[model samples]
Structure formats: C-alpha cells, structure tokens
Target: MPEQSKRLIQLLENEGPMSIKRASAKLQVSERSIRNYMRQANAKSTQILTDHSKIWVQERKPASLDFSRALPQNYRERSSYIIKKKIIEKEEVDLFDLSETLYVSYSTLKNDIAKMNQEFHAFQVHFRLKKDKLVIFGEERQIRKLISHVLAQETATHIIDMETLLNNYDKNLVHIIQQEIEQIVVHPALSKNDLAKMNLILHLVIISTRCQENGGCANDALALVFRTEKEKQWFGQLIDHLQTRLAITYAKEDLEQIQVLLAGNLNFRASEPSFEMDQKNIRFTSQILDLLEKRFHVDLNREEVKELFLRHLHNLNIRAQTGGFIKNPMKESIRQISPTIYEMAIVMAVEYKKYFQVLLPEDEIAFFAIHISSWIDQSNALNQKLKTLLVCPAYLNFQSDLLQTLSTRFADELYIPHVASSEQSGMDDGYDLVVSTIPLSTVSSQKVISLSPIWTPYTQQALSEKILKIKERKKGEMIRNHFFEYFQEPFFSVVRKTSKEALLHQMCARFNEKEIVASDFEKSVLEREKACSTAFGGFAIPHPLVSSARETKVSVALCPEGVLWNNDQKVYAVFLLAINEVDKRVFLNVYEPLVSLLSDEEFMTRLSAQTDFHAFSSLLIHKIK
Candidate 1:
C-alpha cells in the first residue's frame, strides 16, 4: 500500500470518524488525494470505511500487510532500503520492479539513487545502474561503514530495530541473535546503557546478516590490538554462538574485524579501562585539566579524577577511530543545565581536534561535559552552598521550626547564616538569596522567594527552581562585572547591518585604528571563525584564535537590522574581543557565562534590542541582579 494510504487508515483508526475535509486538512493533502487514499487503502483490506463526508475504520482483521516491516516511504528510507538490499545483502535489483514496490516512478527512483550516491560520496560508497540492474560500488570497509551509518540512524529512535529488518533476515534468526546478545555477560566497566547496548546488538546483527549472505566476502582490513584477554575471550564466545546458530563459518579477516569492533565498542576498554592507560590519552587528559585550571582558576589534577577523564578520552578516541557513534539522549539537557561545563567540554573537543584533526559530535561533547560537571561538583562541594537569609516574621517557635525544615530539606545546598524579621529585610544586603514568608519591597524579585508558612512538595519544587535561577544569576553577575571593565564607551557604536565577514573586517579595522590589537588580528579572528563559528545564542563574539593585543578591550557593535553570521544564524549584537596575554583568563571568565546567559532567548532578544550602549549595559546589569 502507498504510505499515504496507510497513514490515512491509521489516522482514521486513531481519531475515529473524521470528515473527509478534516482528514485532508490534517494530513495536508487535497480532498482528491484523500479519496484516492481511501480507495487504495480499501483495495488492500476492507479496514477503511468511507461515506460521502466522513471516513472511519472497521474492526482490524488478521493483518494482510506486515506494516512492522516498513515499506520505503520517504527518500531517506527508500535509499536505505535500496542500499541494504543491493549493497549489504549483495542483491541485484531491477530499477522498474523496485520502483513499483516502492510506489515511486522509475524516473523518480533513478533520481533518488543519484541523490543517494551524492550523499554517500563522502563515505566512498555509490550505487550504479546498468541497463535495468542496480549495483553497489564500494570497498568492503566503506560499504560496511555506510551500512552502519544507515542502520544507526534508522534505529536512533529505536522505533525500527532487528525485527524491522525481517524482510532480509529470517524472524527466527533475528530472535536468536537478540536473545544471544541479551544473554552475553559483559565486564563491569562496559556500558549497559540502552543506547550502548543497542549499538552492540545492531553491530552483531549486521555482522551476522552480512556473513550469512556473502560469507567470506564480508571481510575488512580494519584491525584492533586487544588490550585485555577478557576482550578476546568474549569475542571468541560471541562468534562461536553466532556461527553455531546461524550455520556459517566466519573467515579470518571477519574474525579480526569483529575483534576490533568488540574492543572499541563492546569491551570495558572503551569506557572504563582498569588496565594501564594509553599514554596519549593520559597526556590529553592532563592538558585538558591544565587548560581548565588556567582558564577557570581551579585545580582538578587529582589522580582519581585524572584517571577517570583519561579513560573517557581514551574511549572517545577509539570511537573516533572506529566510526562508533554512541547516542546521548541527555545531551540537550546537559547543555542547558550545566552550560559552563558544556563550554568547558567544547574546549576539550577543540583540544582533541588539535591533536587528532577530528571534531567530536555534540553527543560526545555532552558526555565529556557530564564528566567535567561531576568533577566540578566534587571539587567545589565545600564552597558551593548558597548563603541564604530566612525571614519567617512569626513567633520564635514558628521561626525555629521553619529554619529546621529548610535545613533538613536543603542542608547540602543552602547555608542559612542569618534570620531576619520582616521589618529588618530592607537592612540586609549580604545574603545571596532571601527566603521569606512575606513579599518584600527592598529585595529584588530575582534574589527573593516567597513561600507559604507551611511547606509542601510543590513548595520544595518551586524553591529548588528559584535556587537554580539565583545560581545562574550569580554567575551572570560575576561575568557582567568582568565584562563591563573591558566594555568602554568609546569602543561602543551603532553600525548598519552587513555580511559577517564584512562586519568583522570593519570592527577589526576600527580596533586596529585604536592600536588595541596586533597587526594580524583580523586574520587570526577570521581563521578562528573558519575553524568554528563564534556565533551562538543570538550573538557573535569574534576574537583572534591566539591572543596578542596591546590592550584588552571589547568593541560592541549594535546591528538593529541584524548581521548574517552564517546560513543559520543572524545576530544583532557583536562583541569583538581583543585580549592581551595577561587578560586571556579574564576573557574566558566572561565568555562562558555570557554564552550561558545569552542562551536564554528572551534575555538575548531584550539585550540585543537596545540601540544604545548605556541602555544595553543598564539592561544587562539589571538582568544580572
């Protein structure tokens, strides 16, 4: 059945008895297409029932179509289906016949193949058509890599898994492989997370399927030096089980490739190595810690933390080498909740790129951020407590009870050093935050929280959120203080919006005229921009890759019409930074917090909308408070 027809049937089954017009509108299809969908759906099965105006579904019958095995619906899916069959399965396909199966015309199918070939060019894989037969052209390693990429994306959401590939592999065989993977015992250090486990399972499944179909032809040149005897034993046992169940003898090259795969992805060596560390990773981890220490003014070179970061970097390097991409579902949350740590991870990624010439993915960066966040949490545990003032404004007994409740609830996070009556609230400005039972006119709303005399789960949740905001605001205030020192009135100006490069050149020239930066500062800034964009969170901070300035200064350019920083980002605020050698650390202190604070879309918009420097500075300082 056509994908549209199947979708229409499913929609009717879900929503139940929707008018034809409404169904057409919901699906974003024309009424005529809706009618055609009903006709096509009923042609296969009498599940869809339609009248003049409305469409509904009858009782679902024994399934005539196995929707579980998804038909190639869109271009991506269609390309994947073709690649899997013709390349991975090594099956010759007639274009006309395959096009009919996919419900796309032969010409459209040809166009898809062309586009797919273009997309796969970087992977060194291609599809070629001669006469009517479609064939794949690529080395075994490239072909396997492409296959891994496709399958990984297909199963990224886990909606499509081993069972979905039943069209190529036997149902019984898929089940056996899944069961074998489930039964396999891995080392304690190996990841058992859902995403990591799925990657291993899918890798094994693909190996088995390719070996079963093409036998020894699935061999590759990839190799790995097993760091432990346990990894070798595990690989041997896994291969033995698969060979016995699937009735195939693996080749020597295939065995070696599997060893590399296991060591890089499935073995404990990938994530948490108990054995001797790789010297390169040890150096990289040390350098990263040193950078963090120098940039953020904190030492994290303790042996325990060093070993942990070393293992993580070693595993990350292995993933880069082996084309192993582990999905991190918490990447966005991690970025938001601990953006300073995320920025630190980006620095690590930049250093890694310098060493290996490979840029890590966002997920990997996020994983590194988690490690750094934990380290920061451990190192700062003693000093991270929030200094708070409690204002109960009740009887002595009730005030003591309130303090006890707060201490019991937030002992680790909050340090209630002072207690003030409602009348004394205006007199104290020393506390980081004020937790009061009554609203106060003196305290900034950002620094004050009003709660009921009685506490509940709702109160706890609200207070926790307020505390997080206070911490974020405190960070912003620190950055703002360092920032305003370098932000001069003479350096601030309003400019007509222009191209990113043009605006950057203009600003660099202005800085050069002021003799604040080196002669080649513009070149260095453009080089840095080329390496990695500085435009983020609705603002751009362009600076030299290596700082060499006569004086540390930040030139502010307000673009009311917006400057096009890249294809995706347009910015109204540009902070061109020129940092002297002595001020490099100071620049970094301002950079991370500024990025985090500007990540708030509302705040960025409000700050960028200011036409004058005074207005922008005032609004920023106000927001910080």
Candidate 2:
C-alpha cells in the first residue's frame, strides 16, 4: 500500500477519527484521497473509523506499514543521481545496464538524461548519449560540482560524510585536496550553510580526482563581480596552487564559477561594525520597499512590515547567490488559505526586477506573502468599526455625556463621528448605525438605537450588541459588493486549454481587447510566473507586478482538464488580475472565494463546466456567500 495508508491510520489513532476536510487539510491531500486511504487501511487492519462519508481510521496495536515496504523511486531524482555519478567517473555509462539496476525502464531514464542536459546548459557543460552510453561533455570543475549535488542528497543531513565519499572515489586524493583548501581559503572569512559546505568539499574532491585523469574545468565561462583586486589575486593564487599540485591546467571560466560558488555562497560580516544590517543590504531592502510603494496603493512602510521584510530580504539575497531555496513545505497551504496576501506578494516581488539581477523563487515570495498576511489582518481588525452618529439637541451636556459613554464602552468597535441636534440631518449622513436621544427621520428609525441619557450600564450593553450585529452586516456587504462589482459576465469564460502560459496569454489578450490593461500587463504576469509559479491547487492567480490597468478586474478562465502549472502542480481555473489602485484595499475580499474553491473539487468541476456567464456568476457568488 502507499505510505499514505499508514500515515492515515497513524493520524486517526493519535488524533481520533477526523473529518475528511480536517484530515485532508492537515495531511495535504484531497478529501477523496483521505477516504481512499481509510478504505485501504480498513482492508489491512481490523481498526476502523467512521463519520458518514468523511472519516479516517482507528487503533491497531503493533501496526506498521508492511515491513518489505519499498519507496517508489522518483524518476527525476534517481536519473540525476545516476548521470552525475557516471559523469564524474570519467567514462561513458551504459544506459541499458544502469536502467536495469535502477529498476526503471530504459526509455524513462533517457528522458531524465535529456532534462539533465538542460541543467548543464548554463554551466558550460552538456551530455552526449552515444554508443548506448551517456558521456559528460564539459570541463572537470563544472562536471564535479554538478555530480556532487547528487552525492550530497544520498546522506540524510546536508553535511557531507567525507568517509562515505572517499569510499566511492580516491581517499588519499581527497585528503590532499582537503589540506590545500584549508590552507588557502582564509582571512575576513566566508560562510557556508550545510549544503553549500558539502558542495564546496565535493567540488574539491572532483578537482583532485579529475587532475589525476588529466582534466580541468574551463576558466572564465562567465564574468563575476568580485569584492576587490586583492581578493581576486588571492583567489587566483589559490587556483594556481591547485593547478601546480594536481599537474592540471584550470580554465578561466571554471575558476570563475568556482570563485562564485565560494565567495557568492559564503556569508561574510559587513566591513562596517556600526549598523546591524550591512549598508548595502540596508540600501537594497529600502529600494525594494520604495519600488513596492510605486506599484501598490497599500502602505507597507509600517515598522513591523519593514522589519519583517528586511529580515526576509537579507536571507533572500544569500539564497539567490547560493541557489539555496529553503523548502517551504507550507507553501501550498499558505497560498490556498491566504491568496489575497499571496497575490499582493506576487505583485510586490515584480518590483525586485528593477534592483536585483537575480529573481527570488515563488516559495520566497509566498513566505513574504505570509508576513503581509498578518499585517493585513491586523489592519482589518483595527479598522473594522461601525460608523456612528449621536443626537442630543436638547442640551450640550447630554451630547457630551452620551458620546463619552459610547466611546468608553465600544472604543474599538464604534466610530462615533457625529453628535448632533434633532434637526442636524445627522441620520442622512453615511453613518452605519445611529445612537440618538430622539429619532431623526423615518428612514433612520430602524438603525437609530435609543439610549438612556443617564448613560446606564444596561443601555450601554444593549447598544454594544446592536453595534456588533451591524458590523457583521457591514463586513458581509464589503465582500458581496466588491465581488459582484468585478466578476461580471463579460469577465468570465471557460478556457479550452489549461496550460498556465497559454491560459495567461489568452486572459491578458482579453483584458487588452477590452482595453482594461496596458500592453505590458500580460508580460508582467508571465515574468512573475517565471520567477516562481502562481499555480495553487486547481487555480492560477496571475497578475502584473504593478497595477497599471485602465480598471481593476479579474479575467476569469477555466480548464476542466488540468494543465501543468509549474514543476509540481496543475491548475484548472486561471484568474488573471489587473488590479487598480482603488481595488487593492478589497483584494482580500475578492480572493476569499479561492480558499473555498480549491478545497471542493466537485464545485470547481461544476464551475469549469458552467460556460454560461449568468449561471456561472450566480453559482460562484452563491457558493462563496
């Protein structure tokens, strides 16, 4: 059985029988999947759990997955591993033999090799499959670094076990290499994460072994910005030492790439000691914020948002340099749950294009989105209040006393903006709820809650309850009004294809045809996708980095049959955004439906099938409300 079966049984026993919705969300699986796992678990064990159609399993002592359990090998991971090993071995690897050993079909292995070739493309390396064997076609250094990433994955922790590594290659050669790197790489110092450190060591071993095979990495494949001439000379001296010791000539490009791997990945303290953040990092972070201000009407200059973004940006710079992407396992759930924040984050990330050459991955963007999510919620809570008007025409003391009482009782919930006479037409103003000594108008009778002029506690309690109910109604209206405003029939459609790129292209074209967006809006959306995919669940919420549209609206398209969204997911619904300055405030309200839409497959299927605009609009608005 799949491992999910065992996990399901274990979860049920530990947490009690869970509803499918709760279990699926916790397990990161679909409701149908959780149910299927339940059935599978029941077949193998006497333990059972039930709750209508939505359920998990129960206790089975001594329970474990079958002992002979073998993890289904991931084709991509294994293929990369095999290719890297073969390339480092400096001999053509027989495809037919390797495929059999890996318990995979030869044809599948070939496809993996083809994909690997693409990774090698940027690094001055390529692979050739000839004579029924795969051959590495690149310099020694590039070859080794590529292969080392594969070996590093074999261990549980990112730190390399030198003992295990030498067992596979040459022990003495690696030892010499270790001794040399320790001697040269010193001074102001560079830093390394566990993974980067392993990568560094592995590349050294590769260089040492390849020297024995009369090989070296190409030099100067790409130019890199180094800190100073002294540092450049120091790096050059180290490379020269390696060449002399190994009796191999290193390519300028190979040396350049290695320098980047070392200097680029390692963390170095700022030269100045005064400020907490390095001046450069501080400047870069500030620039990013400034760019965001230019793009969105939403104010992100709040101290809390600034501090959090700075912390994330500092890490992101390091990650970009080292190609270090700390996996955000919560990425899917975060996007699915808080899409408005995620959407804003996506657009904010576009501003990075102006300052930095490297782009942060979508995972990083999602993490940033999470930071913004907290702020938005806080702002909402702080700002949600019932606008109120007070009437006390008879005496000034009465108005003052009543105002003071309401403020004391409902400080956070009520905004008492007006205190007026019975003739002030206060009720005609746009106050949400009215507190009056006497009724002002026939229209305001229902909203005007009469309160005691003596400011009694009993009267205060009743008014507070009434205000709470009004606030709920206002909140509901906030969502309903904005949603209905944007999601008109003209904006909705059932797209024929689900490919994210194609779908986005078609949606943007529609927006342009309507003259809703600038010509570059679609390009911006695609650029965002290139940095990190926007695909979440069966939906892709693509938008420009900055809202430069004629009007703010979501261009809706649905592909009932899923299309490949990114490396890992597929999306069926595509909501291409062209948000305006005004719409930014209601973004969360607009996208709240996404959280529900992704969870219910049956609903999304019905949505995708609803080609009629009126029916689609009604069904969607109904489901959401």
Provide TM-scores for the models: 0.31, 0.31
Worst 10 residues of 2 by lDDT: 60-69
Stretches > 4 Å off in candidate 1: 1-385, 389-429, 434-456, 472-484, 512-524, 544-552, 560-562, 579-625
Candidate 2 local lDDT, 244-286, one digit each (tens): 7767776543454456445422322111221145566667666
Model 1 Cα displacement at 552 (Å)? 4.8
**Taking the tens digit of each residue's C-alpha lDDT, what string does model 1 give over 490-526?**
7887878478878888889988897777689999999
Model 1's alpha-carbon lDDT is: 0.65
Candidate 1, residue 222: lDDT: 37
